[model samples]
Target chain A: MSDLRSGSNLEKVLKAGHFAFTGECGPPKGANLEHLKEKFMPLKDIVDAVNITDNQTAVVRMSSWAASTILIQNGLEPNFQMVCRDRNRLAIQSDILGVYAMGVRNMLCLSGDHQSFGNHPQAKNVYDIDSMQLIALVKKMRDEGKFMNDEEIDGPPRLFIGAASNPFADPFEFRVYRLAMKIAAGADFIQTQCIYNMKKFREFMKMAVDMGLHEKCHILAGVTPMKSVGMAQYMAKSVPGMDVPEALIQRLRDAGKGKVAEEGIKFAIEQIEEFKEMEGVAGVHLMAIEWEHRVPEIAERAGMLPRPKI
Target chain B: MIVANPKPISEILDMIKDLKKILILGCKGCVTVCNVGGAKEVGILASTLKIARIKGGNPVDITERTLERQCDPEYIAQVKDIVHDFDGVISMACGVGPQFLSEAYPKQRFFPAVDTTFFGGAVQHGIWAERCAGCGTCIIHYFDGMCPIARCSKSLMNGPCGGSAGGKCEISKDVDCIWDMIVRKKMEQGRLDDLVRFKPSKDWRTARDGGPRRSIREELVI
Candidate 1:
C-alpha cells in the first residue's frame, strides 16, 4: 500500500495486502548455538518472521542479536526485540547499529520486564530511555541518520521499528491511545502481549480503528497456545498485562487431558479468523513460548500458512 | 522526604564490633517521620547495640542523641561538643545522616544505621511509600499526580509494559502498577487525549542520569 521503507519480510507481507504471521523465540539462558538453531528449525518455514526475544520476561538469556544472527545464518528472518530495562540510550543506539550490521532488519523496541521478575533482581536498572522515547530515537536514527543527541551516524541502520502494546492492561480505554502513541512515535508494526480476553481485545481494536491506528501501523495480536489447563491457570493468575479470562481457562480445562493444547490452538485459530476480518488487525503474532513445534500446525489450522511468500 | 529502613541488627553489630564506645545519632526529619532513625529508634538501637556487644564479650558504651535534622550542618554542629566522647558514631538517619556527620567530624567514623530507600512520603502511620525519584524535572502534572519515574519499577513513560497484572507490578504483588493508576486516572478525568501521542524520550540530563545534581535557588541563597 505504501513504499516499503522498512524492507523487512514482515513489513513486506503486510504492505503487499497479505495478512502477516510472525513467531517468537527466546534465546536460551546459555550460549548454546546448536540448541538455539534446533528451536528455530521448527519456525524456519512456519512464519514470515521470528521475534528473537532479548532476556524475555527479564530472565537472563543469550542475547537476541546473537540468536537472531544464528537465525539469519539458517535463512529465517528475525524480528529483533530490544528492551529498555537493562540498557540506556547509548547501549540501545549502539546495539541497534550492531544488530543491523549483523543483518537484523526487523526491530521491536520494548520497555522490558522489570529486573525483579528475573534471576537478577539485585541488578540496578538502566531505564534511561523508555519505549516511547526509544520509538522516537529509532525514528530519528532511521529517518535522519542521527543519534538521540542530534549526532549523525555514518551509515544509518535501516530497521523496521516495532513496538508492543498490552490491550489487557488496566484502564482498557487508554490502551488504544497508547498504541496510537507508539505509532505516532514511528513504529512500523506492533505486536501485542498474548490475548485470551478477545472481548476486551475487540473493544480495544474497535477503539484503535476509531482512532485510525490500523491505518497507521500493522497491529499483530499476540497468541500464546496454552499447553495445558495448568498453563492456562498460571497465565490467568501470574502473567502481567495478560487477560486470560476464566471462561477460556474453563474451556482449556474442559479440553480434558491431551487435547488441551489443541483446544488452545483452536481458540487461537478462532481469534486469528476473527482478526482476519477485524477492522484494525493486520495479523497474529504466534508466541508459542517454548512450544515452537506447534507453530506449523497452528499456522496451517489458522489458514495463515503456506507462509505468504512475496 | 526520604524513606528508609533500619539496617539489620546483625549488620549494625558487625559495623560497630571493634568499637568500645559509640554514639547513636538520630534525625527528627525524615527518619523520624519514617519511624526508622527517630529519637525512639535511637534508644532501641543503643540498647540493642549494648546487648550485642556484651554478648560478643565486648561491652560498648552507647550514648543516644537526636538532632533536629541530621542532614543540616547546624544540626550536625550540635554534636561537636560531645563528639570526642565516643570512638565513632552510628548515625541512624538515612544514608545522608552518616555522610553529614562524617563531614562535620572528620576524625569520628560514621556508619549508616539505616538504608536510604527512596524519596517518598507516608502512606499510613507505619507504611511509607516511594513517590519521587528526585529526577530534578517534574512531569507529574501529565499523569494526574502519579509519577511513573518514581513509582513504576522501570520508570516507563509509555507503559503498563506487559508485566502489569491486575493493577499489580510483575516484580511483586505488593506494588501497584503506576501506569495502571495513571491510565485509570486519565480515564476518570476523561483525558485520553493526554496519552495519544508519543511522549518524547525523557531528558535524563535533568534526571540523576546527568550526574550528581544540585538545585541552587538564587533568591534563597545567602
Candidate 2:
C-alpha cells in the first residue's frame, strides 16, 4: 500500500484518458472540525484529490497539516500545501519531516503571497527561502537525504513534490525558465495559475515540451469558473496578470444575468476538453474556490469520471 | 558611505571555490542600516552560499558571524581569533570593511558580497536616495532644501532642463526629474526669479578630484 501510494500520481492521471479533476479545500479560519468535515464529505468521491490550502492568501487559515491528516484519515486523498511565507529554515525543515510522520505524503511547496496582498497587511513576511529554494530543500531531504539544517532524517518522506507556475502572469520567456528551475529543484509535478486562454496555454505547453519538461514532470492545467458577470469583470481587471479575453467576456455578457452560472460551467468544460486533448498535459486541476458543489457537475460535463486503476 | 558595485554571489562563490573552510562576515553598521549586511541578509546569503557549495560538489564548512562594525579597529580585533580558523572570509559589509578586514588579517583572503550602493538619507521606510556625495562643501542654502546637484539628472545649476518630460527624467522614463520638481516648488512659492539668479561656480577643491577628503573640529580634537 505504501509503495502504491508512493507512485507518481501523474502517471495514473495520464494513463486515464478522461480529464482528471482536483479541487481546493480551503482551511477554515478556525480549528474546529465541524465546518471542515461537513465540507470534506461532499468533495470525497468527486475529486481525484483535494488540496488543503496553507494559509491561502496569507490570511491565517487552519493548519494544512492538520486538515490533510483529517481528510486522509477520512479516506480522501489530501494534497498538503506548505508555503515559505511565514516559516524560517528550522520550521520549514521540521514541518516537512513532521507532516511526513503523520502519513500525509503529497506536498505542494509555494513562496506564498507577500503580506501586503492579504487582509492582515501589516503582518511581517518571512520569505526566508523563496519557492525555488523550498522545492530544493525538499529535494535535498528526499534525494540527498539531508534537511535544510543539515540534519539527517531517519527515513525521508517519499513525498510526491509539486510546485506552482503562473504562465498567464509571468513574462513568456521567464515563465518557462522559472518552471525549469522548479523542476530542477525536484518538482515531480506542476500546477499552474488560473488559465483562461487555450492558445496561450498551448504555447506554454509547447515551451515546456521544448525544455524537455513534458517527459520529466506532470503538468496540471488550472481552471476556475466565473461565478457571475461581475466576478468575471473583477477577475480580468483587479486580478494581476489574469487576462480574460474580450470574446469570452462578450459570451458571458450575451448569455444574460440568469444563465451566467450555466455559461461559466460550459466555458470550464470547454477548457477541460482542450486540456485533455493537448499533448503532454498530465491532468486538470479544477479550482471551484467558494463554489465547491458545482465541481461534480462540471466534472460530469467534462466527461471525467474517476478511473481508479491504471 | 563609499559607493562600490560588489560582485554577484555566484561570482564570489566561484572565486573561493578552492577554500574548504569559509567564514561569512557581516557588518551591522551601515550595511545593516541599509538592509544589506543585517542578520536576516547574512542568514540568507550564508544559506545560498552553503547550498551552492554543496550542490557544486565542494560541500564547504561555512560559518557565519556578524560584528557591530567591520571597519572599526576594535571590531576587527574581536574577529582576529575567528579569522585565523577560516581559509577565506566573505564580507557582507560595504567597501571599507573588506579593506579594513584584509589590513587586519593579512593571512586570510577577503571578498565582498554586497555592492555598497550610495551615501544618502532615508526618504521613507526602507527607501533611501543619494543626498550628500561626501563633498567637503555644503551648498544647501543655494537650492532651498533640495540638492539639485545630486538629485537632478543633468545637475543643472540655474533651472529646469528640457529633458524633463511629464515630470520624469528623459534618460530613464521610470525616474522623476528633480529639476522639474525644484521649478514647481519655486513657482508655488512665487520665487521663480530665484531660479534664474547667478550662482557662484562650485569649488572642486573640496571634491574627490582634489585629494583625500578630510574633516575635523579643533575643539573636538582637543
Candidate 3:
C-alpha cells in the first residue's frame, strides 16, 4: 500500500507519473440504467476513471452520484461531479457524504452552467456556494473530517478532489490565476474545458507552470473529437468559453463530408500527442460526449491503451 | 432608487372588474421617478381603465389621487377621508404602495398596479438597470465599486464564471458580465491582486435568505 491522497486509480496513475487518460459520460435524461451502462462500457478499462457529469449544461439528467454508484457497481472508478447550480450548501454537503458512503472516491467540484441554458429555463438556481468555496468545503470535509460548519464527522469522505478550468474564457489573463485559486482551494486534479485552440492553451499552461500550479495539482487537458463541421461551427460560435480555432474548423471542412469525423479524431490524436509532452499537462480528459464508442479507438491511437494496472 | 414597471392594463382591469367605483392612487416617490406610477401616469391609467370598462359595456367611475409617497404613513392617511367612497382602490405605486394602503385601510381592497422590481436607476431616458441587491452587507468597495450580487447571473463572489465571454453574461448578450467589468477595472489599475484573494462562501444571512429582514436605527427610534 503506497501513501496516496485518495488511493483511487486516477490518483495512483497520476502519482506514479503515467500520462493519465480519463473519459466523461453524461448521465441520461431519464433512468435508463442499461443504456447508461452501455455508454460507459467501452471506457471500463480503456481509461483510468470516468467522469459522470451532474446535470451537465444545467439540463436535467440522472444524478451524477447515482450514476457514479452505477459505474462503481460495474467495476469502474467514477469521478463524481457535483455542480453548485442545483444544490444549496445543505444539499451539497449531504450529497457529498451520501456519495462517499456509496464507495465514490473521486469528486469534481464545478460551478455548473446557468439554469437558463438548461431544459428548464424557468428553474430557480441555487448557488449558495461558488465552485471556489465548494473546493474548500470538500477539502475541509476530507482533510479535517469536518463539515463547512466545522462539525466533526464520524467518518470523513477521503476523496480525490477535482476541479474544472476553462483556459479559453475571456479576460484571458485571469484564467491562469483562477486555476491557481482552485488549486489553493484544495483541488488535487483539474480537467479543463475541451481544448481546440492549442496556442492559447499552451500559453495558459505556461502561466500555470510558471506559477507552479502544475506542481500542486495534476492538470488534465480536455479533448473532445469533433464529429462534424456543424459541431465544430456550433462550438465555435455558440458555446461560451470555447475557443474553437478557425484552422481546426477548416481542416474538418477540408476533410470532405464523409471524412470530417476522421479528421476531427486525427486532430484530437495530434493534440493528445502534443499534450503528452506539454509542461503542466498530466493527462487528457477525453470528453467524447455522446461519442463514447469511439473513445477506445481514440485511446488506442493516442497510445493510451492498456491503462496502467496501478 | 427602487425601479418598477406598471402591471398590464388587462391585469389591472381584471382586478377591478367587479367594482363600479375605484380610486387610482399614485405615489410621488420611486415609482414616480421610474415613470411607472406618477401623478401623470395615474391620470392616464384612470382614463384608460374608464375606456376599457366602457367598451366592455360596464362603465367604471374612477377617482384619481396622487399621494406624496404611499410608503409613508402620512401620505397613506391622506386617502382615509375618501377611502370608503370607492368600491376598491388601485394603488398605481410599486408593490409596497398597495401593501401599505391595504394595511392602512383594512376594509378597502388595495390592488397593486405596478410590480416593484429592484433597486436600480434609469440608465437612459427609457432604460433601467439593476445595481444593488440590498444584500445588507456592501462589498462593492472590495471589487472597485461593482456589485456582483445584483449583476452576475449566479451572484458568484469569486466569478466571472466559465460562462463569461466578451464582457457579456451567458444569459443574455445585453446583460454585461459585472465580474468582467470588475476584473478589467482591477487590471487597469494594476490592482489585479485585489481579486486573487478567495472570496469565501457568502453569509446569505445578510440578504433575504435569512428571511424577511428589518433594520432599526437605535438613534432614530423613538
Candidate 4:
C-alpha cells in the first residue's frame, strides 16, 4: 500500500507474491570478520534476506549493528536485529540512526532474553521499552519522521519493521490477540518463534486468519531443523516457551545416530512445503542456528532455491 | 515494606574488626518488622562481634542501641550525645539507616549491616518477593493490582513476552509470569479487550531515570 516501506529485498520478494524464505546467522563472540562472512555467505544466494541475530540467547557477541554493516559490505541484504535488553531509548534511537546511515534497511525488534540467562547474569538489564513499543517507535520514526519525544528527525530511517511472535507461549488464547496488537503497533511483518507443535500453530494461525491479521502484514513461520536428538531434547525440556513435541523428539531419535541431521532437514523441508500452501503463512524463516553451512542444502531441497531477483 | 537481607557475618566482622569501640544500631522500622534489624538482632550482633573479637584476641568494647526509627531526624538525634564515643557504628537497619546516620554525624563512620533488596511484603512466614519498583507512577490498577514493573523480568508493559510458559517467567521457575496472571484475570473478568489496547512507551522520566527522586507534602510540612 505504501510502495515498499524500505524497498528491501525481503519486502520486494514478499510483495512479488513468492513464498519468501529467510535465514538467520548469529554474530561471532568476537570480531572475527572472516568467520562471520563464512557463516552467512552460504545464505547469500539461497534466501531472500539474512537475519543477523542481536546477541541471541543473551550470550555476548559482536554488536548486531556492526555485523549487519559487514553483511551489507559482503554483497548481502541484512535484516538487522535490535533487542531491548541492553539499550535505553537514547541509545536505541541513536543506534537506529547510525545503522540506517550505515545502509541498514530492515530491522527486527525484540524483547531479548533476560540477562540472567546469559554470561553476565549480574549485568543490569535496560528494557527501557518493550518490543511492542519498539515497533511503534520505529513506525513513528519512519512514517511521521519524528522521535519518541515528537521532535523532528533530520533523516528518518525507512526500515521494514519486523516483530517476533510466539504462538506456543502460555495463555494460549491470548497469543493471537497479542499478534493483532503487534500488527496494530505497526509491525510490517511477523517472524514467529520456532514451531515444532504443528497442531498448536495451525490453531493459532486459524485464529489470526479469522481476525484477518494476515491481510494486514506478512507472517513468516519460524523453523529450525533439529541437528541431533540431544538438541531436540534440549529444546523440548530446557527452552522456555518452545513447543517441541514429544513425537518430534521420537522422530529424531528414530532417525538413529548417524542419520538424524538428514532426517531433520527432511522434516524442515516438509514444513516449508506445508507453509507454502498454508492460508496465512507468507514465508518461512529458516533459522539454521549454528548450521548456516547447511542452509543452501535446506533451501534447495525445500524448492526455495533460485531466490527471486526482484 | 522495604525488604533486606543480613550481610555475611564475616563481612560485618571485617567492617568492625579495626575499631576498638563500636555501636551496633538497629531500627524499629521496616527492618524490625522484617526481623533483620531490631533490638533483639542488635543485641545478638553485638554479642557475636564481641565473641569473634575475643576469639581473635582483639577484645573490643561494644555498645548496642535500637532507635524507634533511624530514618527520622528526631530519632537519629537521640544518639547525638554518645554517638562520638564509638569509633564507628554498624547499622542493622535497611540501607537508609547508615546513610542517614552518616548524614547526621559526618565525623563518624557508619556501616550498613544488611543489604537493602526491594519494596515488598512477606508472602509467607519467612519469604518475601518484590512488589513495586516505586517508578513514581502507579499503574497497578490496570493489571488487577499486580505490578508488572516489579514482577515481569523485562518490565514489559504489554507482555507475557514469548518466554512465558506455564505461568512462570523465563528467568526461573520460582518466579511467576505476572503477565500470564494479568491476562488470565482479564480474561476471566471478560475484559480481555482492555489488554488488547496498545500501551505506549512508558515515560521513564518519572522513574529513577530522572535521577535521585524527592517527594514533598506541603500540607504536612510545618
Candidate 5:
C-alpha cells in the first residue's frame, strides 16, 4: 500500500510516479468567496493541487486557511500555506490543528515577507520561529503526535508538509545547503521561487542532485508566466530575491506589442518542458498569480491537463 | 550602548500639564552620547518647559539636573533629597532612566521623556543605528560580525528571506541588507562554506523568550 500520509491528491500523484503539476491562487483581499472561486473553478481539474497563498507579498488578504477550506468546499484539494510572520507559535500550532480539523491536508511553510513590506508597515511582527523551525515543528506534531511543549496531541494532523525555496536568493552557493537543511527539518517537498535563471537553476539542481536531495524530498520548480514587458522589467529590477535574465526580458520585448502574454506563456512552456527532464526536479508548480484565468490554457498547451488521479 | 530618541515636546508637556513644578532629569550616559539628554540639553529643556508654561498663563517652577548615569543607583540617589519638592520627574534619558528613578524613589512619579529605542552605536555624526538586541548571547562572529537579530527586519538567523533587492532590505532603501553584506564578505574571502552550514534553531531560552533576563557576576559580587 502507498504511504499516502496526508491522503492529499498531490501526495498520491507524486507517489504514483506521474510528474506532478500544481497551481497557486491568492485569496481575495476581502472575504469575497465569489472572486476566490472564480479563480479556483478554472484550475480545479487542471493541476494536482491548488496552492492558496497566505497573505502573499505580505499584503493583507483573506486568510489562506479560510480560502483552502473554501477550495475544499468547491470540490478542489487545497495546499494551504502558512507564514511565520504575523503569528506566534501558539497561534501557529492551534491553526494547524484547526485547519486539519477542517479537512486541509497539505501545508506549505514560509517565512513571510516582513510586515514592513506590507500594508501594515507600522504593525508589530512576530517571527516566533522561522520557516525552517516551522517545518520541524509541524513534522514533530505529525510524526510524533506531540506539541512544541511535548504534550501529546489527541489526534495529530497527518499533513503532507511543503516549503518554499528561492534558488536565486543570495549567498548563491548556500542555497542548496539551505534546501538540505529544510529537508532535514522535515520538509517533504519544496516549491521554489519562480524560475527564470535557467543556467543558475541548472547549477543549483546539479548541487542538489549531487547531495542526493531528490532522494530525500520532492522538488517542484516554480513557474510564473510573465504578463507583459513591464512585468518582466519590474521583476528583473525591482522584485527582490528573483533572477530574471536579460535574454528572457529581451525575448519578451522582441515579441512586440499585444503579443507579450502569449510570448510569456511560450517562455513558461519552454521552462516547463525543460523542468520535465531536469535532474532532481520532480514537478512544476505554476503560480498563475493574479493571472489565474490563463492557467487552464497554459496547462492545456503545456499538456498537463486532466490531472493524474491517484 | 543604548539608543533612544526624545519624545515630542508637546507630548511631554501634556504628560505634566496639571503639575505645578517638575524636574527634567538628564543622563550623561548613552543618551548624552546620542545628544538626546545631557547637561546642555537639561538647560534647554528646563527653559523650554518654563517658556511653554508661561505661555499657557500658568507660571511653574522647574529644576534641571544631569546625572552622570541614570542607569546607576548612585546617580539616581543624588536626587533623593529634592524629589519631594517636585510633583514628578521627567526623565530625559532612555526608558531605563525613568525606571531606575522610579525604583529608587518609589513615592515620586518618574515620567520617561525619551522613548527607549535600541542598543546601537552611531554610524556617522548625528546618525545612530541599532547594532545589538541584548539577547544575552553573542553570535556576531558567525555572521561576519553582523547582528541579524538586531538588523534583519525578520531577525532571521539564516536568511536574506527572498525580499532582498539591490543590496537593500525590503523594509526600505535605507536599511542595508545585512545578509547581502555577510554573503559578499564571505564570498570575497572564499569562505562561502561558512554560510552554507546549518545554523541551528536559536536556543531562545537565553533570549527574551526566557523573559526578563538577568546577569550576576559571582566573582564581582560584594
Candidate 6:
C-alpha cells in the first residue's frame, strides 16, 4: 500500500536543499546511435537528471526506451517519459518492467499530445488508461510487486515516479487541485509545463500552500527559453494552455529584434531567482531546448551552483 | 459506424449543469476509431466531468455505458428501458446516431457527447485520412486509385509540387506529400506517363461550392 523505495531517491534529492536542477531534451527524429551518445554527454554531470521525450508533439522520434538504454549505458540518469496515447495496458506495464531492468530509474507519466496535435493527425490515441489511472497502475505495480496482468516481477522497479502539471494552462483553482490528484495517485514529484509568468507562478505556489500540496509533493518548476519572438508567439498560440505574460513579451519586445535570445535567458534567470524563496518549491527543471550550453550560466545566476549531493 | 468529435471539458461540464442523474453514453463505432467516442473516452470524459462538477459545488450522478453500434435500430432499442432512469442521455455517437435515438424515443431528451467531424477511412494505425468528400462522383479509375481531391495537400490533379522535398510537404516537414506517394506508386506500376495525359480541370458543380450533392439509384431503393 506504500512505496518506501519509490520515494527514496527523490527523498535524498529533496533533502539536499529546497533547490535542485533538471533538464528536458526532445529526442531526435532518426535512429542514429551517435545522436544518443552526443545528447547525453553534455547533459551528464550538468543535470540531476535528463528527460528523454517520447515522440514529443506526435513527431516520430526514437523510442524513449532505446534512447534511455543508451543514456544509462553512458552512465547518465535518464528521466524516461511514457505516454499512454501510443500503447495499451499490456505494453505499458511490460515496458515499465523492461525499462527498469535497463536501469532507467526515473519516469514521468503523461497522457500525451492528441493525435490531432501531432504531425500524424489521423493516428489513433490508445489511451487505454488516462495518466491518473496509469499512475495508480504504476504505484500498484510497485507496491503489490505485480503488473496489471497479475504476473509477479523478478524485481519491481524502484522508480521515482514523476507527473506533469500545466499551471499556466489549467484553470487557476483547478490546476493545484489536479496536481493534488496526481500526488495522491503516487506521483513522487511534479514537473510542470513550461513556466512563463513568475508572478503568476508565485501566486500558484501560494495556492499550492493553501491546498497542502506543497507539503505533499516535490514541485519542479519548468522553464524553456524562447528562441525568437516568432517562437514566443508560436508557444503562446500553438501550445494549448501555455500562457506568456505581458511582462515577458515586453522584455523581449524591448530587447528588440535578434536580441531575443539574450532577453530569454534574462527572463529565465529572473524566474529562477523568484523561485528560490518559495517554500515547498523543491527545485527547477530548466529545459534549455536545443541550447543546453547556456544551462550552466542560468544555474550559476540562479545560485544553483555545485552539484546537489544526494 | 458512430463518429463523434471531442468536446472541451468546460463545455460538457456546462451541459450537465445541476443534473444529478447523468449517463455518459459511448459508441464503439467510427467514434472509437476516431478516439472521441468509445468506452475509454466515455470513462475519461465521465471522470473529468465528475471531478470538474464536484469541484464546482454541484454534485452529479455519473454512469458510463458504451454500445456496439449507435445507429443500428436494434442497438437503439436496447437503451429504451434504461433511458428513463437517467435525467438526460449524453450520446457519444455520430450526428445521425443521436438523431435516430431521439426519433426512436421521443420522450427522452438527448444531448450529443461528440461533435461529428467527417467521414473518412484510416490511412495508418491511428491516423484516419479523409478519402471521400461525398461529392457523389467517382474518379478513382482516372487517377489510378489515388484521390487527389481528398489526399493532396493542394488538391492538385497532377502533382509532385516543387514544394515537396524528400517526400515531405513544404508546408511543414511533418506532412507527407500525397502526390509524392501517387507518383512513386505510378512509377512502380509503370504508369508515370499516364499522369501526363490531359485531364480537364475539375468541375466545381460536383463539389460543395456549387451546392449540396446527392446520389440516388431507383434500382437500389427497393
TM-score of each: 0.95, 0.60, 0.98, 0.99, 0.91, 0.59
* Fnat of candidates, each listed: 0.81, 0.00, 0.78, 0.82, 0.44, 0.00
Best by lDDT: 4
Residue pairs with backbone overlap in model 6: A122-B126, A122-B127, A122-B128, A123-B126, A123-B127, A124-B126
lDDT of 2 at A7: 51
Error of 1 at B218 (Å): 4.6
- Lowest lDDT sum, 10 consecutive residues, model 6 chain B, at B156-165
lDDT tens digits by residue: candidate 5, B98-132: 89888888899888888889999999998999999
Q: Which candidate has the highest TM-score of all?
A: 4
DockQ comparisons of all candidates to the true complex: 0.70, 0.02, 0.85, 0.89, 0.50, 0.02
Interface RMSD, in order shown:
1.6, 19.6, 0.7, 0.5, 2.0, 20.5
Candidate 4 residue-wise lDDT, B163-200, digit = tens: 99999999999999999999999999999889888887
- Candidate 6 chain A lDDT trough over 10 residues, lowest sum: A1-10
lDDT of 6: 0.74
Preferred candidate (DockQ higher): 1 or 2: 1
Query: What is model 3's native contact fraction?
Result: 0.78
After superposing candidate 1, which stretches have Cα over 4 Å from the reference? B217-222
Off by over 4 Å in 3: none
Compose the digit string of candidate 3's lDDT tens values, residues B1-222: 999988899999998889999988988999999999999999999999999999999999999999999888998998799999999999888888888888889998889898889999999999999999999989898888899988999989888888889999988889999989999989888987778898988888989999999899999999
Give lDDT tens digits, candidate 6, residues B1-222: 323468777777777785788887888888888888889999998888888887988878888899888878888888877888888888888887778888998887788877786667666776665676554466768777777666654455534433344566544557766766766676678874575443433545666756866568889977
> Where's the lowest-lDDT run of ten residues in candidate 1 chain A?
A169-178
| Model 2: per-residue Cα lDDT over A222-307, one tens digit each | 88998788888987765655668878888899999699889988999898888888887778888888887777778777887664
lDDT of each: 0.86, 0.74, 0.92, 0.93, 0.88, 0.74
lDDT of 5 by residue, A1-310 (tens): 2577788888988888778999999999898979998989889888989999888878999999999999998889999999999898899999999999999999999999887667887888888788888998999999999998899999999999999899987667767878888898889889999989999999999999999999888999999999999999998877778899999999999999999999999999999999999999999999987888889999888888778876
- Per-residue lDDT for B17-71 in model 1, tens only? 8888888888899888889889999999888888878887889988989999987
Q: What fraction of native interface contacts does model 5 preserve?
A: 0.44
Regions more than 4 Å wrong, model 4: none
Off by over 4 Å in 2: A1-5, A8-19, B1-222
**Residue B173 alpha-carbon offset, candidate 5, angstroms:** 3.2
